[model samples]
Target: MNKKIINAMLVLGMTAGLAAGTCTSAFAEEAETEEARGYRFTWVNPIVGLEYWSIAEEGMAAADAKYGTDTQTVGPTEINVDEMVKQIDAAVAAQVDGIITMALDPTALGPAIQRAVDAGIPVVCIDTDAPDSARSYYAGTSNYDAGFQAGQTMAEMTDGKAKVGILMGGINASNMVSRVEGFKAALEEYQDMEIIVTEDTNADLLIGTQKAQAMMQTYPEMTAIFGTSSTDAQAAGKVAEEMGITDQYCIIGFDDMEDTLNYIREGVVDATTVQKPYEMGYLGVELLVQTIEGNGPEEQVIDTGVTMVTADNVDSYKE
Candidate 1:
């Protein structure tokens, strides 16, 4: 071969070998990238200290393990809409792959939720929903149905002739409002039943207890006390216990928190509606994952059924 042709041929061979090596390395890196990094999901509840919220956290953790993703649960110590909005904002700032939240105040959280959605983060509302917000899905119990059930149960327990009092978180919350309305509507069917006192404790357990105490004193013939929220239920139960009226009054509460269950077992609470909070949390994460992968269902609302738990059925709820 001529010297110039030999030199050119050698350079071409070396260049081809280097290109081949680079291609192999790139392919290996791509494969590893897919295997190493999974999706990251964040869940924000209205309150983290509550047992019902912990059940939701449990479901979220299960989903995280199944999907091999980093999942986190953060929320306010109490039901503070402002704190929840701040947490949502921080989740967006952290650039999580997806966010799931419980919208305590549908109106107040709408803008923050929209901001997260606008930032390209998939947002799902669990437990409570912000219908006007940019949330992709809502996974929770049918609040109206749950409330209706509560109403029916309360009516039966009170024999449709008892005077009732209501303890609620807020009138503005759709979930609380739905329960109150359903209870009222059901009670109206029975002409003998009357709801004389309704009070909003603003999500304060102490305030709820105080309100319940006042109502108990004001309506000396109050037959039953219904709590629309978990904290309110706890307050009513505590007040009944303190006033030595557990035997005389019927207490029906919402949510099957530990204390609530104990009250039922002790006969302080006649019954409570047990919402599937853990299922809500689990389904929310699962839906977010499917949506991110473009395989989720188009359904906007997911109804996790509710159960009525009383001392008779409290054994079934253990663990």
Candidate 2:
């Protein structure tokens, strides 16, 4: 990658830490006596079958219940950018007050997002971002920092001498690429530990497993794996266990899914950085509602932060 592109992406990551610095609860009181304005917001996800969105839905429900905001969740059964854009267009046509969505591809969702913004409907991106789009705010983890932290942890565990491979959800996804960049940046000091291969999963578990298997077969000496998505990490652990090499390699993954947690508990996955999808969904709705009501928080980007879950803390997150 060109140095300029890398720097630009890093700057995009840094934007997450910049905010209006207003507390979320401060605006709750602002809505107390207002008539149930009943603003409707639709949350468009890339896919809805994954367990990752369950908590996010819960967050949306909480916000809706508390604020009387009408919320609807919609997405395709799989990663179809075309279907996602159609949904966005439908929401725009309906003139919904707000649209909360994840940008699976940076450019695929750009026009739909722009149309929404042009229609005076607020669009707030959560989970993944399309920074060039006209979205009002981004609420999610700093994927670069998440990847950097994972890289630092990998270095510590492998003594900076392990060969590493990567399992990614979508090769072109902005969030995934930024994570790989951050991971590479962190590993710069540990010259002996280098990324040997990166395989795309296309947001599919079976594909993720197949890629993980291929990576293991092609690089038998590989001592560590980085899963850039929830499915990728969970599938990597499953593949390693099926091959009976769980003890031979270390797996560091993103998201705290049940299988990922089990992998950590069983010592198959060394560690994972858990994202607060619940908060993303919850705050995403809140922010959009505020924007609709003219009391939106001053923060442009809300960094929900992440938790590094290991065997020691895995049990606690189970609840």
Candidate 3:
């Protein structure tokens, strides 16, 4: 073993170590790229087939297309909490990367949502929130504030004094309950504007019509009606028109449904509060992706904002 032979062997050993290190680095980079492209997410809504939920679904699709996320939506055909719970449990069993859901019944859905969270799946609530659950964030308009906005508009339409009836959808829904509470809070200042009747329509347009008519009959001199949901609001207007008293009742409602907009244009509804369900659907995906990637928002609740639409702005929303 000569000294020159030993030096040549040491040089060869150094070269082999460098080549192995470069190969390892390339493999690590490839693995990272694959992980980036493979993230999957699922969105769960309380119920499907509603125009509002359809809009939210559109937003989810937009986000999926833009971000290259493998996203899907699951929901019940009707407002059934048990069905929604089953959908969520299935998502958890499948081990999705993340979940976005509208908690129709916070208390009932809390345990299921918590299980997802405990399993290391990030959860975000859109539209209706399960605040008591282990959700990481909320992306939607404040129901209470939206209701307050509706109430304020109602006060202006009736000149702060009128006999009013209330119509609502899915009375047990947390969002609807908050909206009703906020509406009542707003009217507390208007002593003369009495709320004569309040009823739930089970989110059915036809039922809303019957309830609205019943309210009118119960409060024969009712000067205004406030609907906490789109169907409820539109029904009040339709009932007034059918009863040939559209000119007499001041109707206000929520959401920007086509029929609701028509009611506004025809002056049957004085105004309606519009929510950004599109934003909720879009941002829900964005935030969940962020959380999964460790870049989520610091805030717990994200307000998507609300708009009050009357005849003045009704034309813009018509299509």
Every candidate's CA RMSD: 17.3, 6.2, 16.4
Q: Model 1, which residues run further than 4 Å from truth?
A: 1-37, 317-319
- Candidates' C-alpha lDDT: 0.76, 0.80, 0.77
Pick out the ten consecutive residues of candidate 2 with the lowest summed lDDT: 14-23
Off by over 4 Å in 3: 1-36, 317-319
TM-score of 2: 0.87
Q: What's each prediction's TM-score?
A: 0.84, 0.87, 0.86
Among all candidates shown, the one with the greatest TM-score: 2
Query: Cα miss at 168, model 1 (Å)?
Result: 0.4
Q: What's the CA RMSD of model 2 in angstroms?
A: 6.2
Backbone clashes in model 1, listed as residue pairs: none
Query: Which scores greater on TM-score, model 1 or model 2?
Result: 2
Per-residue lDDT over 128-186 for candidate 2, one digit per residue giving the tens place of the 0 to 100 score: 87778888878887889889999998998899999999998888878888888989999
Over 67-141, each residue of candidate 1 has an lDDT whose tens digit, in order, gives 666778888777688998898899999999999998788899999999999999999888877777889888776
